[model samples]
Target: MNLIAKLLPAIALTAGLSAAQAEGDALHGKQLYAVRCAICHSLDYNGVGPTHKNLIGRRAGSVQGYAYSPALKNSDVVWGEANLKQWLSEPEKFIPGQKMFIAIPDARDRADIVAYLLQAGAQQPSKTP
Candidate 1:
């Protein structure tokens, strides 16, 4: 095979990642979070679920105070982008017996939400009042 053929697959992979990243629009993510996640979660406080702030790099279910399921609390899951996306896609499948019951079937929505979490998580966290 020629050099161009060897490079084609790598180029395509790069483009695919770029496209996925680009799909996560900030405004759309914020809107979707309000509509979809705010019922049980918040950026600052622990509601039905734990706060989403500082979630990207933190271990899953390691947040203090909130009662996590035994399955999640015992497991070791660091919330990188890919795992976070997977958890958003299917909570039970990602971590069996976890309390969260929602699933974002659309990949775009997951991407947007993941983007929003990462962006927001990087900023100063809100006070948990």
Candidate 2:
């Protein structure tokens, strides 16, 4: 192999590794959920807010007992990354008279939280033997 041919394989390998790293460590939103969101939202049980065990890809107002605001309950918006982003940016703006109080100031943080929620939602429960 010529010098360029030998170097090409190395370059491709480096790029592939970088892409995989990005996917693996790209759970930025989890940090936001831990610090900013855990106070209100719980993963398996209802805290001040409802549980988020499977928030993403679920229907709005679908959780069994928690009473959502009329504005939120009436809407047909599906819970996903895009809707979560908007809701995090400004809860009041997204649904007037909603109970959530804080606004997410950073867009990147919101994106990270969304990614974390989705990943967490997808996890299967481990059985204890």
Best-performing candidate as measured by TM-score: 1
Q: Which segments of candidate 2 are over 4 A away from where they belong? A: 1-26, 123-129
Q: What is the lDDT of residue 76 in candidate 2?
A: 83
lDDT per residue (tens digit) for residues 37-97 in model 1: 9999998899999998788778878889999999999879988878988998999998999
| lDDT (Cα, 0-100) at 71 in candidate 2 | 74
lDDT of 2 by residue, 1-129 (tens): 699998999999999977754443335567667889898888898777888877767777677888887777887888887888899899888878777889888776776677788788654556699
lDDT of 1 at 83: 90
Structural similarity to truth (TM-score) of each candidate: 0.77, 0.73
Reference-based lDDT, residue 11, model 2: 99
- For candidate 1, the 10 contiguous residues with the lowest summed lDDT are 118-127
Question: Clashing residue pairs in candidate 1, if any?
Answer: none
